[model samples]
Target: MANPSHDRDPGLVLGFERTVGDEVQAVARSAGLVVDVVLWMLRRGGWSVGIGCGAVDEPMPASPREAAGPAFVLAREAVEAAKSRQRMVPLAVRGSDEGAALDAEAVLMLVAATGARRSAAGWEAVDAVEEAGGTRQEDVAARLGISQQAVSQRLRTALYDETRAATRAATHLLTTAHP
Candidate 1:
């Protein structure tokens, strides 16, 4: 059965589930930025994900008062839309009223591009850089014992810059909300 439960994005309070997929896709997109943060930390490397902003319902107990809300409904609809269109990621945006909204279609395209284009070596390089806290590509190359140029090429081929930029924006949205 589906583990129907309302979960908050870890390290960032939001109504959403984290790591919505298993074993990390080459690219993925989540409707919530906080979910991206979790994905970034958990990804097997070279994987990229986008974040969507919106409201979502947490799974509630037997109490109807705590049931899921419109946000959850909207997110569900977004996922269904993506599936119908064979998009790479699920998207749901609550617009400015909720948070940093993203165009689901755009995110789907970017994510699909990453998944379709990433290579195994590229994934390893990207993962290493991220695990090291976005370290310099030169440093990553040295660690991987490859030419800096090679690392640069891998990152470029994987669309690492664009993917990281999106993830960073999503993270900023989550952090800025608290302080």
Candidate 2:
């Protein structure tokens, strides 16, 4: 059974609902008829196909198990999107416990934008660190026989490049929105 409380409400964001619905429809099409029935139930129960908000008093579920199938799929898509650098707004309830939930929401948005896979360099770095059984920058550098300074420089460069890319994207968005 779908949980009504877990439904997404995108509030005043026009087109967001349709965008979400399209994503659901894609998933439904992929999963065939069984999942389509689940999606239909979720939509009828107030879950937005895109962005969803939590009620001030009623919070979204913390675990995936607590969410309806469509809501879970939407959350997963949002997370992938965010990881891919797509812009998305996360829905959160108002409370202390809601902070983690909000973070989860943001993660979903990122995933929906990006994907499960990290960049090649990012994966390489992570793999190297894991193989060395050391997570610290200096330790990883030592295991790789490189100076910590070099590792730091590489990391900084990567960060700067990503920052530049993000800045350009933001600028483009602003220009398009105003123009």
Candidate 3:
């Protein structure tokens, strides 16, 4: 489901709901939505995510599972690839443009790997900034009960800006390869 929603990019997830057991099905029409979904799954952990970008039949279906097209077929294949053994990154992207798909996957994996190495305190600082919606560092420091310098240090060490840039790149790549 579209759980753990965020306001940092509300438009990325304006109206999404998922109701499934042991799994969830979703469709993202834009690059931002795709990246938002990927971030959500990564944060929750324990998900083998597949992002399929391509053409779907006209007239959207009631449910994602009921939808059909190259996108669906690519997504199935991507999921299988994600679940493969020795997969360092638990996500995959398959699209009409093979080059873009590979680029998107590489960039997303970098973001994921960087996130995985963040410490609890680092996440605390990062989340404070993200939740505040372009808030000042001092504000984040006050919220986290840490010194402003500490907040800066944490964000720096976390490579928050770098990761954010990487995420944006991934979104663009996905959009090109899929849409």
Cα misplacement distance, residue 178 of candidate 3 (Å)? 2.1
Candidate 1 structure lDDT? 0.49
Q: Give per-residue CA lDDT, model 3, range 1-179, as digits (tens).
A: 14545334444322343435445656665787778677768877898888888888868776666777898789888877887846656888899999999899999988887888899998888888988989999988998888999999999999999999998999899988965
lDDT of 1 by residue, 26-143 (tens): 1112334344533433243333333323333455333322445554444445444544553334333333334334443354345545645678898888777867786888898899
Q: In model 3, which runs have C-alpha deviations exceeding 4 angstroms? A: 1-21
Compared with the true structure, all predictions reach lDDT values of: 0.49, 0.36, 0.79
Q: Write down the TM-score of every candidate.
A: 0.56, 0.27, 0.88
Best by TM-score: 3
Q: Report how far residue 56 has shifted in candidate 3, in Å.
A: 0.9
* Model 2 whole-model lDDT (C-alpha atoms): 0.36
Sort order, TM-score high to low? 3, 1, 2
- Which structure is stronger by lDDT: 1 or 2? 1
Candidate 1 vs candidate 3: the TM-score winner is 3
TM-score result, candidate 2: 0.27
- Give the clashing residue pairs of candidate 1, or none: 6-58, 6-59, 31-52, 46-123
